[model samples]
Target: MPTYAIGDIQGCELELQRLLERLKFDPAADRLWFTGDLVNRGPGSLGVLRLVHSLDACAIVVLGNHDLHLLALAAGNERHARKSTLDEVLSAPDRDELLHWLRHRPLLHHDAAKGYTLIHAGLAPQWTLGVAQTLARELEETLRGAHWQDFLLAMYGDQPERWRPDLTGIERLRFITNALTRLRYCTTDGALALKEKRPLASAPKGLVPWFQCPGRKSRDARIIFGHWSALGYWDQDNVWGIDSGCLWGGNLTAVRVRKSKPIEPVHLPCEGYLTPGESGD
Candidate 1:
């Protein structure tokens, strides 16, 4: 099967459509793996959600930070939605169904046959593939269960920036969520520096991109992620980052992946929907 991994859409629905056209996407045979942040920042978030949700079995998505924020808003966490461009999604007639579908999406997707894992952002340097999968399932179950609203309530925070096996309750889940969604830089000892969103070269002292940190446990497994538009389309250290800043007037990008072969980026320039600093991802 032909598989394509696409970057953060961030409400650039038209760019998404055009990129799909460029790939000659065939719903019958081509599989799409989306690197999340499906809504927010750009215009047409509602349209983007509808289109991706309609893809059904042809697509697999991992939730990004903005996606989680949307769920929080859907659950009445309005404070975080103040600067969001997701009003259209909230007001849509099919809001409940769409939100329900989105909330249930996984935080991480692994394709064992292809030897690549998909996530919205980078994993913690401490987690092996097995441990990462286990952590992902923990959050996935909470998001899909009866107490999902509670999860959304406790989901927003940046505390306990480091991961530990003994960490319990919301602190543990929060760290896992941040590492998988909002992560950018980390200290030498693997303490997450979530606030540092600058490019790798300008990263604060003693910090490096999460993938470049030494002694990473999942280094042997390939990781494909988005959520770092500033990092652009990076392919090093067995990690592939495809977020090309579509919401900020950069191109929407996708990489065609075939087992044991180098991936190639397919891109189309976006007619930007929002300027940088106007909204947060």
Candidate 2:
């Protein structure tokens, strides 16, 4: 079976549909992997959610920051930001069902046989693949458990900039969530520089892309991630960054992933949704 790992959809359902058509996606014979950010800041988040939710059997999704934000809003822990395009989803008749499904999605997915690890954003330099998986589950259990609301309420923060085994409680969980869903740059010593969002060439001298941090523990694992539209469609050093700025009128990308062959990326152009120079996830 062919497997396609797609970048952030961000609610651009029409583009998603066209891209799937371009690939001639056959649900019975092919698999789809989403890099997350499947909703928000686009015109069709409601439609996107329903469509992906309907394809549950054939689609694998890791939660993105936007996805988590939606859950927080639904749980009444956050107010919609000024550019929020999630009202449709929040008001949808099937909102509860959709949110439930999204909340249960994993933060990371690793296919040992295929040698691919998927996440919505970057991993901390301190975590090996095994360690990342274990940490993911710790937060996953909380999101899927009864106190999910409390977790969401406490989720927003930039503290605990580095990881330590001794870290416990909400601090630990927030770090995990930020590492897997918001990380972009970090110091050589593994302190997350969450504010750095510029492209590689323009990055400040001291910050290195998380994947390039010296002695990264997950260096040996092949990782696929999104949430860095500024970095766009990168492929190097055992990692793939495929966000491609779909929400900003760049392209929606999908890469055919194979165990022993060069992956092929397919791109579909998008009409600009939000104007340029606006802040977005």
lDDT of each: 0.90, 0.92
* Model 1 regions more than 4 Å off: none
Worst 10 residues of 2 by lDDT: 76-85
lDDT of 2: 0.92
Which stretch of 10 consecutive residues in model 1 shows the poorest summed lDDT?
Answer: 272-281
lDDT of 1 by residue, 1-281 (tens): 79999999988888999999999999998999999999887777899999999999999999999999999998878777677889889989999999999988999999988889999998999999999999999999989999999878878888998899999888988998999999988898898998889877677889988998888898998999999988988998889999998988888999988888888888888868777677555
User: Which residue pairs in model 2 clash with each other?
Assistant: none
Instruction: Give one digit per residue, the lDDT tens place, for model 2 in 1-57.
Output: 999999999999999999999999999999999999999988899999999999978
Error of 2 at 57 (Å): 1.3
lDDT of 1 at 228: 93
Candidate 2 ranges beyond 4 A from true positions: none
- The best candidate by lDDT is 2
